[model samples]
Target chain A: MGLAKRIIPCLDVDDGRVVKGVKFVNIRDAGNPIEIAQRYDEQGADELTFLDITASSDKRETMIHVVEEVAGKVFIPLTVGGGIRKVADIRKMLNAGADKVAINTAAVANPEFVKEAAEKFGSQCIVVAIDAKRVNAPSKALRWEIFTHGGRKETGIDAVQWAAKMVNYGAGELLVTSMDRDGTKSGFDNELNRSISDLVTVPVIASGGVGNLEHLVDGIKEGHCDAVLAASIFHFGEFTVGQAKKHMAARGIEMRID
Target chain B: MNTIAVIDYGMGNLHSVAKAIEHAPGNCKVIVTHAKNEILAADRVVLPGVGAMRDCIGEIKRLELDYIIQEVSKSKPFLGVCVGMQALMEYSAENNGVDCLNILPGHVELFDANMTNAQNERLKIPHMGWNKVTQNSSHPLWQGIPQDSRFYFVHSYYVRTNDNNHEAASTDYGVKFTSAVAHENIFAVQFHPEKSQHLGLKLYDNFIHWDGNR
Candidate 1:
């Protein structure tokens, strides 16, 4: 049996509540993290990722509690990100029922932390999240640059080079978000995804810019992503995880149907 | 009431494993504990592991869990998951090669850097996500789980048994390797049943009902 392409639904949790703003009914009801997670799980989502967008000191405890509460009910793998800086932060998340922890700003701040975290908690549980934006300037040879602090800052590090470095640092997986295409819903930045996917040997999860099932199909087929992570599309009831799987299946893509 | 003790060596996600067992259809009481007495008293034992082999063995040896696992595995129905299954082997090439429990006749090998699947596609390392497991033996764990049922796996290394008789299942990832191993009272899998949806849950259910004799 071949490895099935993963379709992940991402939830942006701000201050213990799921962030709203995506055009959909009961967006208020979707605020309940547990309910949203349960719905996705029931719909047969391959996995779930919760990014704590709050990234505040006070909200850390709340986020941990949210992870614990959601993890208690959801049987699938849960990946928690945002505000994770040190190994201690990763430990707290794991102890709180997170199967894997995604590090972003911290990895950019201290490149060695990736290796340290991978060493302490096995590379399998450490996922390096890279927020990349395409460089429009013609002078730059690299197509993308790594951004941090929720895409508010750029590190000037070549995106492809950084991807290779993280793998060298023992990162087992990569969650790459294309800021250029994120929230746009036009489609996944296939060029950026393909570049990073080609540079790294680990599984690359294509995040951002998914408006429909076709976008997801593009992410896996053209971009060569191991998985696809979308927010608004799944969060606003644009498409169910089952519907996405059906589309991928019809396209001759291997997926876990059950 | 029968108790299923999930061994916690401070390495992997013990709660998730315990939660799955708690949800399994049975009258069994699922306990997540590192206590020697509790583990020894349980009707069945589950060794759930993740993380590097060195740290896993470090904690296992430090807590004297290695002795307990070896002791309980012989008498009761024992199940191992991921690194837990790998730890039972003689040695692992991970972390520049480390010695394992040697309970099973095999050694863990890392997926080759240049590994390619039958389709000649360059396979990704760690081999994450769901893949079908082809059962090779008539073990009780395969009772309800369909043939070639998908199971969730996340590992860069795979096991190579010295004897094919102990190999319960095999899966393809660039190369077909042993995915599940069964020898006498023990049944172990490389996949995380806790994360593998309904099909995975069925394996756990079968484990709870399985007699140690098989």
Candidate 2:
């Protein structure tokens, strides 16, 4: 009886609809947020994260409604990320029933925003999302730089140092995504995850690449993440959240298997 | 009809908590309110909170909820969650030591910064995510919920009752801490039952029908 490493299924929502193809044979509606959320909840997903990728501000209200609908049915922690820019944005999502909101570019634009959000809304409900890619440094030492705008724009900030700074700024949790391995079906950047996980006292959620259940296990075992967040594998019906938990538990990783 | 009043002192989000209670297999109405009369009139009261202990206590006092909470807890079935559980303690080490409601005889302490598990790996603060909670004593809230059920937890500090008899459950996270407490009509937990899925909803259902008796 101990703390179980979590397996979070992330749904990338674009204008209120789930962006990925959730090819679950049983699920009739693929893009419906509530159905997808309920499916994950039934599969024993420890938590659900909805990353709002909608580009237009006018359609952002759709994400809020999606959250409201999902939170009503799915009885688990829900985290909404992607476009959180200010304190009001955080409040709106929380009011919409999101357990936490992930702040990315805004924290980079003004690091004080993270501090202010944490102060106003409490650190427990604030998550800092970091998109990092490996950088070619002069020395042989491993170095990764922070990227914003969905890993498109580079900030030139050191990822590890920025992680520690965010924790100092009162971020309750850090969602570290590896840009290099993301979308590659490769495993997470264990080295990148371990560096930040070891440096910060807060829980580090390993995100990005996760092709199979083994990648999820590696996230906890090798990456030293407190939780593993994956998008494609779970959304594509390649593996269920229950299957991943069972596999992780079989691999000697503590999992909350129902 | 039984009503569950979720004391909302302008802290963290209470929607999920209220929604969870309403979703439970009960016909009760759950209202999130800071109004003392509404809370006192309800048969069950739930104190749901998050964030720092200082702010929780500060807001409770500023709203003059201290008296209301003390008054209702003595006679009604009350449940405290996360920082709400910590707030019932005498004091807390968070925010450089802040005093609490003292409704429960205990103190809240931060997880040791240098603490490690048996693997010698450093344990993270804010011990986030799901953890198995071992029921120390049987209570109405534990009804139907199996022992050692995993529940969602997200907090940096933990509570320790001055008396062990007050403890209802314990969870291991590098240390065996008091995860839940039961005393008379009051039951509190360090974990977020609202986010614990089915087992969590079961606990809420049990609380709804619990009649403040052993």
Candidate 3:
């Protein structure tokens, strides 16, 4: 395949503290976003995505400064999301040194905004972020629905189908996260990931449910995702990019390992 | 003192390119600036980028680096990485239309969509991660680099050589494309040396000690 399984470590910042527990619970402070990102880069992370979990206009200042600092320290690509509601916000993030902008609530509130941002900045600059949880049965009617507003609100759109449409609206990449599996450390939702990946032409990043290196491998092999994004596993010293890549290489997956 | 002026016109990965160079080999001062004089005085100038060829080449025109670079391209060692390398060509990769550096006698076009896994379900686009490199002929830049060694690559558009003489190295995917090329005083690699590790370090070391005059 043209795609290599990506090992991405996401940073969720709340009032400048990196917190992680179980399923987004027991939320203990992890570390500073900047320090965590720097260490991940050293540990050989393919790319980094930062989400300001407590994103608000007030929190924008802290997020921007953190982005600027991390962008300076890390050389690889960086994607910043959350609190990006206005066109000006996207511009500010780009100017502040973010390579790509991932949007969730704002995009669902106004899908037109994704087109506008993509048109202005180029498709490669916009990432349509989807946080979806499986319905009780995930029947034909409930398959792959979109979850937004920090995974509290549900927009009756099918996550897989929505991903397929987001590309037409001009999103460069797709960040599909599973709310149920997030921080579970149990594993990733390969079936859900595969269903959506099959429906989209754009690169689909598998998020949530990464407990160890094997989960990452399953995310790539079973999910058919271009990249596997995790936060708790990489943040809490579960597995490093190097160690994961070693496992991936053992499985005949090509990775940049020194 | 060898100072490498990293051209900054809001059109490329200027900082990372400079960072990689700084982290590479030999003592050199790396500064990202639009200052033409800094470029004029520096021992070497790097025109590096990771954006569209259109945006990058446009900034070069706006900042008037085209003139300074033209002069430096003739005498000193000039290196292009990715879009920087594509710019060395006659014209390639204009998202809106055709606007290019026209340095080398070649063109860069989008990867044949057939090559993308989305299309053929075969080779990937934005060819991410490490892949192997195979050298066709000997060049100093390839010195110390091993055979069948892998390097990091992340791009869809590649420089298609119209003149074979400019071709230096090649990498394989489903099909082989130009990975490294050199013509006269210019040298560039599609695979990122900065991202590439010890082997990449050897690449930087070779470039630093290289005397392209031969």
Candidate 4:
């Protein structure tokens, strides 16, 4: 209730470094995760989250070092995700200093994982990350389906309804990444964003397809969600969080300017 | 020569914050530290973070950085960025319920799932990307930073401070949570000034030159 719309910059990590993939292909290294996170932190980023892309590889312990290194240098709330398939994994992440644990495929595979994590860590520490894609024809009943395995497989789960279930299972927040809008910058899938945000009780973070500032405003005011997440635009330094907030203010969207 | 020593907990990205501060006209010297002496003598203080609030808070306690922060912020220009900003809260409900510096009043809890509404669906977790910052009051940090100037955000939980007067900025994530706050000589933002490009650096510049009048 303090402000409207949040802007976030993401760093997709592979092998303890920052890397970006074009449609999850042709991967390119950005820099050391710690260094890159420092750069984003100084640019007036509200918070920092790390997605250990390699977490699925089962080298989970290594991500802790990454988190430790980055957390030591920067002074922001940091969340870590990827390969978080178990409550014990969540405990390890927390012990490693992660503020929140984001789980996707694992939560879907064992729905009880959501409830268990929530019961153990509190709903505030459990974040349900859903990777969703919009099919060609949008059916009113269930047009969006949950995609897992780095968004390669569809779970046939309704993005809207599944989000509600996560909350029921004691999810503190939802990080929704639009597979279609991801990295495209065509703008966020506002239709999907608004719908999910309107449906969920917990705060919803709209992800993917943020080419510019207007998209962020649309995601917050139009989408009526709690936060907006992006990468390329910020990673490339195309625009700063400050500029985007100014634009949002112009649109009458509440934001933290200074 | 009041220096603003940034707390280096062995996890965050500090170089960028330092570089951004140096980029600005803020005369205050910005230096990353795990030492106490540097913190005690500084005219201003800054804490920028990435990674876990639990770890940062732990390191601060482990290294006895909290006392230094409290001591400095009591009379000097104190600032916290990102997780650093959240550390200023009373406690973090994330990661084994970490106890924070408690410098700023209020606790930061995760977005309650039970709080979600049932009518909508679309947005998702991690709350990453760029978002607007709503200014609720006038402060030195806002001198040049335009209203709605976006700041990069990447956290799911936000600070829920109770003091309305301390709040300087707010961002929506399900519900509005305190984003930027000012208490006497202390000023903290949930956004990163270094990574925020020009507008964010401008705030840092303002923080450097803040006379504490506005």
TM-score of each: 0.96, 0.97, 0.87, 0.59
DockQ each candidate and list the results.
0.76, 0.84, 0.25, 0.11
Ranking by TM-score: 2, 1, 3, 4
For candidate 4 chain A, the 10 contiguous residues with the lowest summed lDDT are: A1-10
Model with the higher TM-score, candidate 3 or 4: 3
- lDDT tens digits, residues A1-258, model 2? 477889898888877777753222122223677888899999999999999878898899999999999888988999999899978898899999999999999999999999999999888888999999999677779999999998889999999999999999999999999988876678999999999998999999998878888999999989999999997787768989999999999999888887
* Cα lDDT of model 4 by residue, B82-137, tens digit: 78888888888888698888888888776655433233433344455456788999
Chain A alone, model 4, TM-score?
Answer: 0.93
Candidate 4 regions exceeding 4 Å error are: A55-58, A136-142, B1-214
Rank all candidate structures by their DockQ, best first, as comma-separated numbers.
2, 1, 3, 4
lDDT by residue for model 3 (A1-258), tens: 223456788898887888776755588888989889888888878788998887456766888888878766676678899888989998788767677899889989999999988766667668889998887473454466888887889888878778877888988788888888887877888888888776665678899888778888898788888888988877778777778889987987656665
DockQ comparison, 1 vs 4, better candidate: 1
Candidate scoring better on TM-score of 1 and 4: 1
Candidate number with greatest TM-score: 2
- Pairwise DockQ winner, candidates 1 and 2: 2
What's the lDDT of the predicted structure labeled candidate 4? Answer: 0.75
- The top-ranked prediction according to lDDT is 2
- lDDT tens readout by residue for model 1, A154-222: 889888889999999989899999887777778988888899898789999998888888999999889
**Residue A62 accuracy (lDDT) in model 3:** 87
For B126-193, candidate 3 gives per-residue lDDT tens digits of: 56556777777787788888876777676768878899888888876556788888877788888777
Identify the CAPRI category of the predicted complex in candidate 2: high
**Candidate lDDT values, in order:** 0.89, 0.90, 0.77, 0.75
Output the lDDT of residue A28, model 2.
26
Q: What local lDDT score does residue B185 receive in model 1, on the 0 to 100 scale?
A: 94
